[model samples]
Target: MKARPAFMLVGAAALTLAMGACSSSGGGTGATTPAAAPTTAAAPTAVTLTVWGPQEDQVDSTSWLPKQEAAFEAAHPEYKITWKNAVVSEGDAGKTVQQDPSAAADVYMFANDQLGTLVQAHAIGQLPPDAVAQVKQQNSDVMVTSVTGSDGNIYGVPYTANTWFLYYNSSKFTADDVKNLDSMLSKGKVAFPIDNSWYLASFYVGNGGTLFGPKGTDETAGIAFTGTQASDVTKYLTGLVKNKNFVNDANGAGLAGLQNGTIDAYFSGSWDAANVKKALGANEGAAQPPSYTLNGSPVQMKAFAGSKAVAFNPNAKNPQAAAKFAAFLGSTAAQQAHYDMRGIIPSDKSLASSASITADPVAVAQMNTVANASTLQPTVAKMGNFWDPTASFGKALLSGDITAANAADKTAAWNTALNS
Candidate 1:
């Protein structure tokens, strides 16, 4: 799901990108070697740098951003850090800067998918030589690909691999119960957003629906949104609305339910972990999204996994300082602090074995899910066409406004929405 494109090239790129597997690997981390580092510039300098991140969303949300800033300052006393109070979100940064470069933060936090747009507008700066080496050495190959642009230059440093997974009340779903979808639905109250395309696509992927062509990012490939496998899976998941235990948590009523003990489990990401723990305390548990029992067998779930990264503004006054700060923000110490203080699963591979991360149930599940089972979300401009249509289709199916008998017709309507 992405914001609509203002140009045709990005849309075409995204559609093509979605139709084929990426130049990297299928889904998350693979055994492949990292891409060779590109040529870069000189060292960062001593200057005032403005930084932006979603620290307000943390458990101790208020302090984590400042803590990182203070640490960054302590290490590089020549650079002064400025915290910009704003939303750490997907749609804001790229478009705003594309419109007016001067307004972009010296270093800013943005979702992985927005990389293409920012790069297109020339709003992001190329990484310095030291930063380039640090990124490849620190983060996984998958993350490096996510932040790299069409021009082949790496534009940012990754922090969190943003994706969804299962968060359950340990007391409600036993160890065995958390392994599959139907089992969880059969025994407990599970809240999921059947209307959100990003979340809804899991069912189709688990059941063999393919989006990008054979490899995943082939420009000549095509979308399988209404193909046989997708239709079959969509029909099957639509049938799940009949389950008495399922609740639509699209607008967060489900989060409330999970917190108040009314819901047994919920489907979400690290962003929701803090509140889930506050709600269930000792009972909070997490696992990869369970497979669905289909044709008397289980189908593994595939999700849209991605990174939340920091990039330097091409227009920043203290260009070198911003580049250094951007690199510093994704460093091991900062990532660990994010995990310890904010519950954000870091993109850095070295920090996985740390005691704080190892002890956290949510962090463990997230890492397992991304490294082993999840698929990378396509970050092309065509992603703009996905969200609203799929959400509308899912809602219509889940609410009983449409059925298998009319599913094809409904899909045709969904396509029309995509075209519009």
Candidate 2:
């Protein structure tokens, strides 16, 4: 599913009132009728700090943006933050920003894939040193390393912590039926987006394969795959599709299936849980993707980690104020508030165990699973180019027209596209 970005800033009315009240209180009481309490000149109108993100069709104004904006404005009373809405119709945020710096917004919400591209292009500015230090002190466990660019400078503040989970129809499968892959397959059908190659990676990794070796290993650093491992993943995926164990619902067919009680499970991100629960009923069960056994123990799945972070445009008109606002966003209180308003998990380790997050039993269990499993590095500019190729290859593979060897060749074609 595509992500829709929403940006909101509380109006200056509250601040205006607060300033006015302060002025009146400080002024002499001799002036009856308040002698027009010196108009506390509106907080120095900082350069309109423009921020853009894809429009969210689902978020209600009262729920997500307004709340965040009110909190941000309340904390920073000296500057006016003007939020602009920009939608990315094609390519990623990095490419969109590079297309026109002036037209590009001062602040942008980018998915993980867009982060590297923005850093590589030098389109993003580093977090002010003081801001970084403050964030570190507040939440020590949130590694600044995750948001650091290839240039070894921090460019963004981690916002959303996303992972894939198995959203199944409770009406279709019982808890006992979903204990393992075999039982799941035997009991009900599974569905996911077939156009994305990452879905394939999720399945392969869930079954104990890695796109890259360990945490420190670079995915593009020429990691080799054994023939046996390749065959195993390919065979497992193909067999699932061929046996009608998994369904590719490219045309909302899966959702229809879900609504009709035909499909058993759907693999999707945590953000979709709310909608999934609404559709399947609150009583439905959610679980982490099943693990594949290696040796004697169950191995975890490899899922992509998508982060939504706030970054300043190097060409922002109000660099200092914008920087300050960005820093405020990374503050402990702000991070927790954001998480509370939206069901998004906070990147701050300090808030990771907070009651708001852990209070939801399902969310807590899924998060625990994520902590145990490794995450795939988010897509950057280079990886964005691979999305189409991977989707095409996956489509062909599902159609029974492409073999594992051909799919490998298709992957090579994707690499070539990235270079081009």
Candidate 3:
């Protein structure tokens, strides 16, 4: 679990009022009995909060979930919390909650890509003002947008970002050579997952194609993968597929090739860091996505960026407490704890300069890509219709079904199918 929750509160005025009430209760009579020791300041409120996350985070007593829950309890002495935790991956949260929001965990983890679905189902709660401020303060703009609902409200607290970047063999190419796809291909073999829809869009996006709208939030704008700019990218990819040094990564071929010394560079997120390190050893290198020349001009390839976030159920029995716990799970301190315990990179900007994060190449690459080379993977419900069509289009390109002669027609068809 990369995401941790945070809840910071202010009660100075309340404390003052409480002190005033206590003083007045004594009535200046100076009761020697001490008035029963101030009646124990009223027992803390009792609350039951159900939490959901992947089993990996709670497989043992020493796991991240139990440790975090214990910390939440200790920090919040205002409540005696009874925790009921269930196994639920962030990827499955939206569908599970939609099945029965009322029965959903009070505080749960979810991928930000599911924000629209969760919002449409009325299962996810919008963040309170304090939490909203915390989210903005802790994350990059791209990460903040990843958890924003269509209504322009922030819906969750992000603890870790999700995005891909370039990983390469530093022994084969200089740092400058890796900055451009053409430069890398000219130097050594490069494996790219062009057949995967999630990875395929970078080429077209690097040119001028847009998903949804310029910011990816306008559902009606649709995917703008048409026109000359998009077709030019398609034509470029047609030539790219025929290049001797270019390998179409499929079925884990990219990572396998790297291990066997057949591939010098690949594209992936931090999830593959350990494997990459094992494959390249001292030669391992990571960077944000590179530019590829199109029409004799440099264009930057951008990946789809999102986050894994903690959200509270709007229908929870203890709504306020649930929301607070969700916020706590994404706090800076919690993010730090998550990273230390599970090796999950924190999304909090305050940790960017920390020794642990700065020392890790994969972490630096992922954070830099999110902040500079990626666009928010839209949370709009319409985005559900995108994957298959683009994927089929990528397959067609890889199979020679799409080429210079048919690039325009195929590109236009892809755009139409996407809108349909």
Candidate 4:
């Protein structure tokens, strides 16, 4: 399987407030008799901190969260972290929070793409200065350029280091048959999340193109489908479809095909490792996407990297404490714990050499591939609007609704929506 980029988009909020109310009465120093001294202060009433994220369900009941909760509780006896699992329907977690604000978890675990919307909604808050410093000291790389928002405030701490990978059911292909993209395709058709434009970006780049050209240096920075790049990318994709090597079933039926032994391979993200394991029943293999031959060398596919981080609710009652927890989650210990249970890669470079991760050949190889060949970029709200239309173009190309020459026109229509 080849790697494809996947974007997690969070909606921004409008306003954020601070909510901290004392839960206990203070004791007087001079008035009370010797027999009436304050007794243990009731353990600060055990504040329940709420947390939200799409990975909540992935946190194994016996393995991960319970241990983390116990550690956090032992460290901060006054706080009790409450996990609230939220669904990321339609690629956005904002809808989940919008449905209920108070019930919305105080801490949100969000995709890198959705940070903008969360910022706009004012649902996320800046971390405390000390906590930010601590996080910087704990995991500088993931924090340095990874979790910062557009406004220059730190919104979240990365909980999962995610990347895309190709997952294949070996039963569909013999050892000799699964050599390269063309060979794999020659054996059987491949499936992709055509509905997911971010995932499709890998296919675009694999053919020597990009969604947006080089950042900062190119005027097209933050723009999608500009230049002749998109046309070239579409042509390659059209060729794949025309050759009957790929199918476009945007509703995940294509993936279902691979799972059911109808297809050989599928493009999926690292986050889907567990799902793929379940689908393939422990007899699957994972690989990096095949490369396009450029200058006599096979240039591997450079897909998008998807990351999830924990952000504080600006309106939370315990900002400082929330910040502490956020920082703790990014620590190497916590990251390793998460990887142990979730199969996600760690953002911290130090953990790259950890025994738990290295013990698994598939994980080690995938992480190395991601580190060497991957691109990370933020996705705008409009990109969400572009997904369906772009997927429609993929379907058109696959179904012959439109010729390769006209793919630009279809893509241009999607770009128009993206820009709108």
TM-score each candidate.
0.74, 0.67, 0.87, 0.68
Error of 4 at 239 (Å): 1.5
Clash tally, candidates in order: 8, 2, 8, 15
* Maximum-lDDT candidate: 3
* Alpha carbon lDDT of each predicted model: 0.76, 0.61, 0.89, 0.61
lDDT of 4: 0.61
Ranking by TM-score: 3, 1, 4, 2
Which whole-number lDDT from 0 to 100 does residue 164 have in model 1? 84
lDDT of 2 at 26: 57
> What is candidate 3's lDDT per residue for 116-216, written digit by digit as tens?
88998999999999999999999888898889888899999999989999999999988899889999999899999887888888888877789998878
lDDT score at residue 401, model 1, on the 0-100 scale: 84
Cα RMSD of predicted structure 1: 19.4
**Candidates ranked, most accurate by lDDT first:** 3, 1, 4, 2
Clashing residue pairs in candidate 1 (N, C-alpha, C atoms within 3 angstroms): 19-212, 19-213, 20-216, 20-217, 20-218, 21-215, 21-216, 21-217
Question: Which candidate model has the greater TM-score, 1 or 3?
Answer: 3
- What ranges in model 3 sit over 4 Å off? 1-40
Query: Considering TM-score, which of the candidate structures 1 and 4 is the better prediction for this target?
Result: 1
Cα lDDT tens digits, model 2, 1-420, are 333233211334455556667657857453433233324446556557665654551155565444565677777777566665455521367788887766677777666456666776667778888877765664322234446666657777766555666678776777766556556777779777766766656555555444334431254642233344444555555565676677886776666677677777877667666666667786566776666443344445656654556777787777777677666666677677766665656666666578887666456545644555436554433445545766775787788766655645544454455345
